[model samples]
Target: MPLLAGFATSLSLIIAIGAQNAFVLRQGLRREHVLPVVLTCAVSDAVLISGGIAGLGALLTSSPLALSIAKYGGAAFLFTYAVIAARRAVRPGAMSPADHAPAALRSVVLTCLGFTYLNPHVYLDTVVLLGALANQRGTDGRWIYGLGAVAASFAWFFALGFLARKLGPLFARPRAWQFLDAGIALVMTTLAAWMVLPAH
Candidate 1:
């Protein structure tokens, strides 16, 4: 029950549309560095979930300075990416995956890391919220619950990164790519603004 609960909870949180998911979907569609991107996301989630299970969540929640730094840095990064996506939307060129140049593995990996780590919400969701929930299960149950959460992360990323290829036909048109990039730009910009803006 604990395991299922953890999996359900983690999936509910992660399945939301976000910057990381947008990046992963784009990479998958382009057929560029998909494996590395998904692996990076899954592994990062595992590490974060483990840290949460180890009680790092408490430390993170108590550190206002750390959260502040993450908020600003994440907002900046997201804004920069949003600009890039907006440019792509305005000047759409590649209509198909074959026409797109493959990005460098290192650059893609670094961007994946940024998407995973820089977002303050990632910490709050995985470390603090998930941690508090998992710890509520008894000692052994907590670890079991964490395992389930980690499993969900790996499953979701792999599915998203791999299954995205199935939509190749839909994205074959330049207009489709333009629309997709425009949407990504809008989402990234909104998230960045939300991070920087004060809560009501």
Candidate 2:
């Protein structure tokens, strides 16, 4: 029951559309460094969830300064990515998934890391929320609960990254790629604004 609860909770949180998901989806569609990107996201989640279960979440929640730093840094990064996406949208010729030169593996990995680590919400969701929930099951059950969350992360990333190729046909058109990039730009910009703007 604890395991199921953990899985459900983690999935619910992760299923939300956000910067990380957008980046993963883009990489998956391009079929460029898909394995590395998926593994990076899944492995990062495992580490974050584990840390949360071990009480890092509590530590993070108590530190306003740390949260602020993440908030600003993440916003800046998201904004920069949004500009890049917007530029791509304007130049549809360069948007073809198959025609463009593949991005360097190092650049892709670094961007993946940025999306994973810079986002304050990632910490709040994985470390603080998941950790607190897991710990509620007590020592013996907490690790089991955490394992379930980890499993969900792996399953979701693999499915999202691998299954995304099925949409290759749809994105074959430059117009479709333009639309996708436009949407990505909107989502990234909105998220960045949300992060920096004062909460209601």
Candidate 3:
């Protein structure tokens, strides 16, 4: 029951509309750097979750300077990504299958690394905070809790990617591509703005 509770907690922490999930779903639909992208998302999540259970993630939230740096860096990256997406949206049919280059697999790896590791919220919610809370059940329960957390990472990646792949057919039209690009831009920009906003 405790382990089950831990697992539920893990799912609640991760199953949300965040940068990592957004990137994964988008790439899955676009059939972009999928293997690498999913791997990056899953692996980074695992490492952070493991560290959270180990109680290392809490340290990040305690350091205001480090937290600020991560927030700004994430915001900058999101804004730049948003601009690229907006360009794709405005330039309809500028790319065709022949013109398309392979998706940035290596870059996705790095981007996911940053998105998972450099987000103060990740550390606060997953590692330092979640880990500490999961352990409250007892040493044995902590192990179950950890497993649950890891399971959440795996389930989310596969499920999200699966849904994206299913949507590929529906988005084959040029106009559909534009719509997707524009949506990506809006989501990224909005999230970036939220990150950059000063706390009230």
Where does model 2 exceed 4 Å of error? none
Which ranges of candidate 3 are over 4 A from the true structure?
A: 95-99
Q: Quote model 3's TM-score.
A: 0.89
For each candidate, give its TM-score against the true structure: 0.98, 0.98, 0.89
Cα shift from native, residue 8, model 2 (Å): 1.0
Q: Is candidate 2 or candidate 3 better by lDDT?
A: 2
lDDT of 3 at 148: 78
Instruction: Residues 1-200, candidate 1: write the lDDT tens digits.
Output: 99999999999999999999999999998889999999999999999999998999999988999999999999999999999999889977754566767878999999999999999999999999889899999899999999889999999999999999999999988889999999999999999999999999
Q: Name the top lDDT candidate.
A: 2
| Candidate 3, position 43, lDDT | 74
Q: Which residue pairs in candidate 1 have backbone atoms (N, alpha carbon, C) closer than 3 angstroms, thus clashing? A: none
lDDT preference between candidates 1 and 3, better one: 1
How far in Å is the alpha carbon of 154 misplaced in model 2?
0.5
Tens digits of per-residue lDDT for model 2, 1-200? 88998899999999899999999999999999999999999999999999999889878988999999999999999999999999999999989977788999999999999999999999999999999999999999999999999999988899899999999999999999999999999999999999999989
